[model samples]
Target: MAEPTGAAAPGFELPLLLFAGFRSIIDDLHRELAEQGHPEVRPAYGYALQAVGRDGATASEIGRRLGVSKQAAGKTVDRLERLGYVERADDPQDGRRKLVRLSPRGIDVLVRSAEGFDRLRAAWVRALGAERVAALESDLRTMASADAFRLDATSWFNG
Candidate 1:
């Protein structure tokens, strides 16, 4: 028996490639976080911390920024709170909302992680040559900013 055309081959190879790379990066980050005494911390928590900002953010705002639901954002915040990486305080202007901010421990972890990222970035730059690396970054950013590619990208500052 012959197979049907559409069902004969699985498509979406390009999206699968993207998914593989994304998953690998997350895995690497988890390994690094484990080494830093934060085995429980996930990449989502780091992203949430970055989005929370200095003034802090409400769960709804975090959900919007992270492309998650408010309930999910609140759950993530709760996990971070248990990890001593974030804290929730009363939002002075709104009794219904609580402001989520990085705790001192969170800041320390973020700084350390950033330092590690910078070091790895420098290695990549050296391996690729500074000029080539710069050009590659620019090209990637341009592609990411294009209408056709922008929707596939997660953040404007992703590069």
Candidate 2:
């Protein structure tokens, strides 16, 4: 609803507050994930991991999904490999291409992440009550488009 006439205009705090809320949830998730032995995981790694998917993907494909250059995606893959989070294999369909697949460690981390998010959501339900939380999620869904639900959100948001 619009503010009444003569009311003060809104500043940037609304967006900032929304971002802060998101940052808080993500930060809490990461903290818990670190405690679970994924201290090396970074925020960016989640997007990269999602892009790699269960079927595996090439650096180029991951790059496309992540809205990053192939070189950048390859670097991320290299780091993930060193961290034991992913492994590269020769692509069966294309001899010249390599597919980046999540290793056991990667799969473990993702499983842990899902559990962590569920716990976090449950905590929110406890604090806000289930109906309010459900309404909040529904409202967010109403505001956000399916097209916005992409791993390439960096470019989507920036552009």
Candidate 3:
């Protein structure tokens, strides 16, 4: 039997390690959020919350921004409404359409979440030092905006 053969394994580089570190940090953030009070919240919920921020939006518009079907967007809106994080009403401009917006309670939740995130960020800066943290953020942003780093191999955001 011939022994399996392959090129010598390349040692882990800084970029690979940084990517792994980022993945771990993201997972930890989600876990922390769940432990804090949003155990039922999912990624889709975050996207919807972001969409419905002060501007308010319709399910169709949310779907367009999130790359989901209108039905999926509506379902997410329903879930958020049930959680008391969002409200839906007839669009003033078009009574036939509905618009969704964050409720006062939802605004409170968002504020608290921002505070918690600030604490988390501060801890990271204290641990990594402001300069290193700044450098890491700059590198991440550069990569995030690069076409090769995008989901469709283009860019992360439209604007």
For all candidates in order, the CA lDDT equals 0.74, 0.90, 0.71
Cα TM-score per model: 0.72, 0.90, 0.72
Candidate 3 steric clashes: 0
**Per-residue lDDT of candidate 3, residues 78-140 (tens digit):** 998998889998889999988998997678666756776677678889999999989988887
Q: For residues 35-109, could you state the per-residue lDDT of candidate 1 as single tens digits?
A: 988787766667888878778999888877776778977888888899998899999998887899889988977
For candidate 3, the TM-score is 0.72
Model 3: runs farther than 4 Å from truth?
1-37, 146-159
Model 3: lDDT to the true structure:
0.71
How well is each residue in 36-136 modelled by candidate 2, as lDDT tens digits?
Answer: 99998987888889999999999999999999899988999999999999999999999999999999999999999899889999999999999999998
Better of 2 and 3 by TM-score: 2
lDDT of 2: 0.90
C-alpha lDDT (0 to 100) for residue 88 of candidate 3: 92
Record all residue pairs in model 1 with backbone atoms less than 3 Å apart, i.e. clashing.
none
User: Candidate 2: lDDT of 23?
Assistant: 83
Separately for all candidates shown, the number of backbone clashes (residues 3 or more apart, or on different chains) is 0, 0, 0
> Top model by TM-score, which number?
2
Residue 98 in candidate 2, Cα distance off native in Å:
0.4
For residue 3, model 3's alpha carbon misses the true position, in angstroms, by: 29
